[model samples]
Target: MAVLEGDCEDSVSDSAKSCQTQSCTNCGGDGSCNMNSVCNNGCLPGFYSLACAQSCGKCGGNGSCNRLSRFCDESSCLPRYFGPLCIQLCPLNCGGDGSCDFQTANCLQGCKSRFSGTRCELSVACPSSTCRDPCQSINGGICTSGCRSGYFGEICNRVCNCQNNGACVQDTGVCESISQTTSVTVPTKFSDGKTAYQRAPAEGDPNNYGS
Candidate 1:
């Protein structure tokens, strides 16, 4: 009877030791063991998993992850980075001097003059500095005041080449005589600067032979 009782006490001790070992194993090193012997307290910030072994991937090293889902938390991207995982770079790097949209990665401000487009990659051509007026086109090829003197054409790209001291037409750019001639007569002037003239008879003059 004494031997049977001792065997029963030993069996109880062995069973208790096994339960303790199992409970300790259930604690995943990240959390303490609960009353039910389950690893349930969750991992520390920026880490997640049953063992707290996984890091928040591409979170710019400054973001936290959801303990249960292991996904990056909202608005956790570092400066110049965006997207849910903080993997995408900000647009144009904020045009190198601007701010970026945290969600869309678009430029917020500080874009250079004549720079446009979503990323500020497209540029508007400036007018020619030599031109006296604004350019009709952004290419600086066509002038609003037309070309300067001695130049002509749609964009004043052509040079005046008229001969015989003629002036060019504004619209057609054609050369023509500067002055016109008439047939009317006037009194003649002598070398001494005296005026001389001869009067012609009218049809109704009294000395006319036909009358």
Candidate 2:
């Protein structure tokens, strides 16, 4: 008589020995003998999954998977393309006109017009000096369009050396040279600067800032 097991009917063939516990029919007793379970035949040479429903195609030669299809596809973006789908056109508004390979999310070949560094993430750094010009080396200034300490001129190039309580104006980047015994010098240059500096900070920097 056939014995009942979970969802499977266990029975011995007429010619077989006395009834015995049967292994899985799917894996052929490969230790994964469970009923209704899928087959894992190693599937072709590059196929995967127990059911082998996914195929990596010829692009799988490089051992890379396509994010969209989960198949073996190009690991990196192709020429002129740089995105997971290899769809982003190069030299777009990636970063300072940097060249971004959307496929890999990297700035390969080269960065945008003025951008530089990895992924074109770094902008032109300012020059070094006691009172470094905010936009010394780059077209824009560090503090945007504003007057520096002890300075009050177009582009904040003039020195005001106000010998009293003074402070730079907000937004306008103007300096208020308020001297104890002298009148305060109002600001002249207007601040007009916009930046998209990456929030990723150094090791000690606050992690929540970018969040």
Model 1: lDDT equals 0.48
Q: After superposition, how far is residue 15 of candidate 2 from its true place, in Å?
A: 38
**Best-fitting candidate, measured by lDDT?**
1
lDDT of each: 0.48, 0.40
lDDT of 1 by residue, 84-163 (tens): 76667765524444545667766655344445556555564523342345444322234556545444555555555454
Lowest lDDT 10-residue stretch of candidate 1: 1-10
> How badly does each model clash, as a count of residue pairs?
0, 15
Taking all chains together, each candidate's TM-score versus the true structure is: 0.35, 0.25
Candidate 2's residue-wise lDDT over 40-115, tens digit each?
Answer: 2333333334533344343323434432355445455434455544445664424434445444555555443334
Give candidate 1 regions above 4 Å deviation. Answer: 1-39, 58-62, 96-99, 109-115, 124-211
Candidate 2, residue 35: lDDT? 29
